[model samples]
Target: MMRRWARAAVVAVALIAVSCGGSETTETTASITDPPQINRWVTVGGIEVPIGTTDGPRGGEWEPFAGFSHTPQGAALAAITQSVQLSTASDRNWPTILAGVAAPGEGRDLYAAHRGLVEISGTDPEMVPTIVGYTIADYSDTAATVDVVQRFSDDSLASSTTEVVWTDSDWRLHLPSDDTATITALDAVPSELVNLEETRK
Candidate 1:
């Protein structure tokens, strides 16, 4: 469960950073327009994540995760891209992924330090969790919360709530100061969830 382990490792920063300190943010929703297309899927550390053709990753020449649009679709795409990167990051690329996707501050440092302490493995490509759908739970010009639904090899479903903030012309994953970001097991995908797989089909 490399994907699940990575997810836990990153989310566990709440407790790990208690002694170090973190950052906080508020959620606000305006109107959302222009749903981004799942132009393709890319495999990172054996985990698959969608890439958008229109909304972002507009700049991947320097860093694969460097360029993203500042729109709602960009934020959502960024949240999904960053989530998969965080969940699948290994020693080989964790630092690069963290640097490109994570917002700068105590939180990112804490996450990096915590991941550094652990030796991660078990990235069985067949068993890894696959992102199935997503919902933009909340959105504003500055911040957005995206609920990403992932289905593991066992066929069970879970949703990770990722919050990203606009920073320096791009959207970066924002680990909540209080460790409030969460992954919840789901009985079934919520009706409101947008199925990116369906869109791709």
Candidate 2:
């Protein structure tokens, strides 16, 4: 996954985030799913997440197929970009990654992995990872999917995808169900959790 490799880099937040090798693409592409009007910004984990559909918003905007899947893909890109792409390896980043994951000990495991990545990469002031590109591989009304490609300073490129769920109020990383975390490109694969989530949506 993009984040798996990102956590091992020199603190993703320091990344310069450039489009892989292709010309940088913006959100102006007309889509059948485009809304009548655009929202200025949306709240995610209390942070004002920008919309990439105009003026080529920078920062946490995960340069991907925005507005294509609306809430699902948009939220996935934001969280992935913020949590993994430009991560500072700070505890503050954990809450957003853990917002909707109610698994008893999942946060600790993810945090530990995150810390390990930072430690492995150490700190490099000159380090900057390039974001090649991302695609919303597939999606459904309740599910959003995406694939992000990035290149670290070492010249190694990695790609990963994640699923996001619209919890009515916010979009969260769609985690593996309690029974089984097995997931596929088009589906979440059933888990032990009856409702997919341990708690109500």
Candidate 3:
């Protein structure tokens, strides 16, 4: 009879210990907080354009390019156009007219060639003309869209927009949505063309 009683006492003590342990675990779990969602816009080129959060029914818009000047590509294009102006009194400069007119990568080679010519000339390198007044518009986090606008010396304007996706703590270019053929095509094209073509279509 003593042996049976001892066995029962042991079982009772074991149950009490398990119940106490479980309650403590539950309390700890309830007290723990979840981590915040990752933000991606912070990482791309360390470029931080201002973004406005939506409040109630009002949406926010951002313009990143309002005051930026002197991008390498823009400067190079301006140099080329200035060179053309010096060679001939044409009313329109070639480089300025062609800015943002072709595929994104296509203009790089032409701009580089212009830079070479600017170097060959004895003009002050700084005054040799650089890109000015480039702008990024509609920068957003909730809607995920951004537009890039570049202006040239001859008053020509070129603009493009691309879809943005938040992932891994950075905003990545979202693949063109497949729900609409038009949107898919725009996404397939270079970012510069995406905005203009989509608007027209």
Which candidate achieves the best lDDT against the true structure? 1
Best by TM-score: 1
**Relative to the unseen true structure, what is the C-alpha lDDT of residue 197 in candidate 1, on a scale of 0 to 100?**
72
lDDT (0 to 1) per candidate: 0.65, 0.36, 0.23
User: Candidate 2: worst 10 consecutive residues by lDDT?
Assistant: 192-201
Evaluate residue 41 in candidate 3 and report its C-alpha lDDT on the 0 to 100 scale.
18
Cα RMSD to native, each candidate?
6.6, 13.6, 30.9
lDDT of 3 by residue, 1-201 (tens): 445333333322211111000001111121111211111111111111121111010111111111111122221211222212222212233233222211123233444344335422222222221112122333333223333332222333332333333222222223232212111101122333312111111
Residue pairs in collision within model 2? 20-132, 179-191, 179-192
Please, what is the TM-score per model? 0.77, 0.43, 0.22
lDDT tens digits by residue: candidate 2, 12-103: 32221110111133323343232222234443322223344432124332332122223433543443444342233334443433332212
Q: Write the per-residue lDDT of candidate 1 for residues 1-201, one digit (tens) a residue.
A: 556645543432221131101112232232354456767787665666677876666433224474666667778778777766665666677787777777888777777766788876746554566777778888877788887777766566777778888876678888655534576767799888777776654
Better of 1 and 2 by TM-score: 1
- lDDT score for residue 148 of model 2: 45
